[model samples]
Target: MPAASALVDLENLRHDVDDALDRHLTRLRDEVAATGPGTTALTDQVSTLLAGGKRLRAAFCYWSFRAHGGASSGAARDAVVRIGAALELFQAAALLHDDVMDASDTRRGRPTAHRVFEARHRERQWSGDADRFGTAAAILLGDLCLVACHREAGAALDALPTDVGRAARDMLDAMTSEVVVGQYLDVLVQAEAWGLDPTADEDRARLVLRAKSARYSVERPLTLGAVLAGASPDRVAAISAAGLPLGEAFQLRDDLLGVFGDPEVTGKPAGDDLREGKRTVLVARTLAAGDDDARLLVTKHLGDARLTDDDVAALRAAITGSGAVAGVEALIDELAAQGLSALATADLDAHGREVLTGLAHAAVDRAA
Candidate 1:
């Protein structure tokens, strides 16, 4: 499997993209500066979350726009870039809040923004409990990013024709709403231990994964760009046909990496999702395999952070023996193939087809 970020030119693009984001972050800092150092802390928190990522969503939006006949150097292109940047800002908001919701301490191999802020509260011996301080700071910072996302998006859309501007706004609204709904479903599913039947649970997990990650990450971004570029209804449907399966494959690959990837490469601890009791399709399938001892091992150690190396090894053995690993891998191949077939049917320019093809391969073959 290739790395999640392996396809792009990171060094060259990073400098330009970072410069754009830095200006945005500086603006955020200046706006918050009057609120005192604590607000500045929040600004830094947002910047940190925004600083690193594959920038896949942004690139997808930009390229899709261009491939759909958006202008290269005119207002259309600039609007597309700003729209992409807005997507990145929205991602920052999601990650900040997601870390809090998941109680995840790390993101991209660093302390999550909330944790970083909370630690500062502790070292400074602030007035409130550090945990509470951290949570509050993180939530506020997340909200800030959400607002910034809209503001940036508005500025971007201002350059477009009124119809395109309205369409862009609608896309942003729908994307936000869908992701939040999916997120709520995810939290509710995990909180209630809702999946007990192996097949049923696995199905639900797959749906949740699609709604929460795949659509927002790939499908919607591509469609949004296409819509802004004035896609016909048939054209929009064609793009979606290609994007949905590919997006599913993308998340399935991510699920695989979450369980089996090397920490050094993935920047996430091995079996972290298992420890988090993520209720992924993989776990559902393992449970459904109906191995009593395997089920027992999962029930006992699945979400226990105190689980040792031996415990994780045992859990891995149980999962593998359950035949879920092979099943999931097969599903990944099926979804990727479905996407490629859909792309073949879509009315696409050469460049659009190429980009989607590259994305499909990169997504499914990704190690992280």
Candidate 2:
């Protein structure tokens, strides 16, 4: 391995992203604090949210940058690290708003930001509807994170050459827009009927996944890094080819985790996705099996706000018995293989390729 590979290693990437985020957020917190006492709440919550991620996005961006010959040290490397920080900030924004939309009570084993604010309101006997107050607060906080994301990104892009910087800036702007559209699509699907056509249901779910996560979480990060490195269209195209499938697999793993993941590990209630009535590809597969009973089970309990442990157990059994879990796992494996295959042929740094392979596996094979 070239010594430069060490700079993009997962551990090093995490440290770099975190360090950059800390510095940026600390300054932000101070700025908010300047407004008056307790004004730092938003920045505090952001800081806390930024602390827990695995930095997968950062890893993807950094490794692709090194692989496509961006830079390994000095100013260019710092710009890349700042870009990674911007990605993390955007992710934090997503988590905050997602919790509010899903009415999620916890995240990463802690009270979701809205819930935390809500509890404080109750404790203080505050006037106005505490629930509404909490929701609004979280939403504003999410908005702040969005602006902060743009700020970090703009600063970093300004440091690069105009052409490459413009390319990366465009990518970052599109990523935000795509994620917002995907979020609405997800909400719309949850509000409407599913399984009317299994194939359509799966396709719609995949569409939402691709826009909401696959591209933003995986493909764009890779492309952004490669673009910053001034990668030829051929190289950028190759990276995207690998990214899309791997990104699909990455989100598929998340779908599985949403239903089956342990709360201890995932920091959310078990079967929370079911409670939220997510029409994931897994749910589509169960219906696709043409099992009426499975369909009935999903229809009855999948989105029940008052679902109990027993109800969750029944739903799990129905899903597993219909072979949906296995089916999804099989798809994950196949998609991962396709991504790895595409990656195999890419002309890039040897060490970067090897690390990317490991990162891909690590992304798909995880407990939370």
Which has the greatest TM-score? 2
Per-candidate clashes, comma-separated = 0, 1
Clashing pairs in 1: none
lDDT of 2 by residue, 1-368 (tens): 22333434544776778888988888898889998997787887887787778788888898888888766787778888899999989998988998999998888989999988898889999999999989999999999999999999999989888998998998999999999999999999887778788999999999999999999888988888899888999999999999999999999999999999999999888999989888899999999983788889897787787999888988999999999999999999999999999889997798778877777777777789
Off by over 4 Å in 1: 1-17
**What overall lDDT, based on C-alpha atoms, would model 2 receive against the true structure?**
0.87
Please give the RMSD to the true structure for each candidate, in Å: 2.3, 2.4
lDDT string, candidate 1, 1-368, tens digits = 22435433322333445566777778878889976765787777777677677777776676566567766567777677777778888888888888888777778888987789889998988787899888888898889999998988898899889998998798789889888888898897887664367777877888888888888788888887787788787887877877788888888888888788888777777887777778888888888884899988887777787767778888899989999899999998998899889877777777656765776687678666
Model number with the top lDDT? 2
